[model samples]
Target: MERTTDPVDETPLTAEEYEAVHAAVAAAAGSRSRSLNSLFADWKDVVEDVEEGYSLCAPEFDDDLACRDALGRAWPLLPPRVRAIRRPELDELDGRFRAATVPWPGRPEEPHQWWRYRIPLVVEAEAGLPRPGGWPLGWEVLPFPKPAGVRVVEWGRP
Candidate 1:
């Protein structure tokens, strides 16, 4: 994953630096099973000591439930018109239809490209957006120029 601006200081850390800080924090915490707040404090201190304008971003998730919870919390902060569409199966009729109609001569043929399918229901809003939460991480959020035939299945927050 690319380095994102630290939410606290808006400073970016190289991937290596980020990993090092995480390692340091883990070592400090030992096996005490510290709360996230304490762990974040450890991370903040490490970053502050080495790099003045940097703080760790949100920790990565290890489970779907945790990812969904994070999404729920972050949902209301998203920009307007952001949409969360479920992954459409390529074997489905609509998926097949979309693949046939969408012209992409240079598009790579790979399983990871499943998002290439036509998204049928687009839920637009500022929160509750789906993300690539599991192994073989996929789209964190859908990209623009959404599939040509997507319908506004629902609008606003649920």
Candidate 2:
């Protein structure tokens, strides 16, 4: 189904405007060898709006709703003919977003142990992600043990 937003200022977007945003987003994702997933799927369209000098957003039904909410605020200032693409129905956007942001590493069948340095050198390098401090960067060289979960861990000299 084609979902559209309320008309702004009695003017609708032109085809060229839509195409421009679409192309910009495609270029961004394509350069990274990634396709636009749910959370950022509408990026192409949004980029077009940005190029036209405005912000636009399309709503979603899942976790992407949070991302959309954060990004939507700027829509009103977006350029002419910029329309937002609504979220997809599959709801897999959340998973895709998670995977994209936080990548899983190492073989599941192998023993996993990741230290802060090791994580940044191994998984982060392979994934082309940045080196994050303060934790092991959520890396696991071995399979996560059964009944294992994350909780607050404090560190300081008493």
Candidate 3:
């Protein structure tokens, strides 16, 4: 259901759609064996309005170096124009990494129009610390306990 000029057309998801989303989330959460990449690849189709890809960053680092290192690795995978937002409230001990893809000027028809899909990473921060061999430039070694939680929100024009 695409949104037109009318605000009423952009109403919240129907009960059936919500149910599907809930089911998908539950499935993702339960699949502890899958990696983060695999989880996103599997469920991206189930969730709607996810044009701007999601991200995962290390928030519970001893220093900014670790945080920046994680962000640098995850940045390339994110959709173009996406930027990181520091979320301190999500985890007071380690904070959280949030990346958002903002619509470019004049591209109102893109997915950034009225709604956005959010997928949260359920990471085991302590387990993913830099190894003695050195931290790789990706999340392959990161301990992802389960697939990310998903949600949709109406975030009108920036």
Better of 2 and 3 by TM-score: 2
Model 2, C-alpha of 68: deviation from truth (Å): 11
Q: Would you estimate the TM-scores of all the predictions?
A: 0.19, 0.25, 0.20
Query: Whose TM-score is greatest here?
Result: 2
lDDT string for model 2 (103-144, tens) is: 224423222211110111111112233323322223222244
Q: What order do you get sorting by TM-score, best first?
A: 2, 3, 1
Number of clashing pairs per prediction, in order: 1, 9, 0
Residue 62 of model 1, lDDT score: 18
Candidate 2 TM-score, true structure as reference: 0.25
Better of 2 and 3 by lDDT: 2
Model 1 per-residue lDDT tens digits across residues 51-158:
221111112211212322322333333222121111111123224334333323345554433323223232222334442331111222333343433322223455
Tens-place lDDT per residue, model 3, 81-112, is 12112122112211222232222223353322
Candidate 1: segments with Cα more than 4 A from true spot: 1-106, 112-120, 124-143, 156-158
Steric clash count of candidate 3: 0
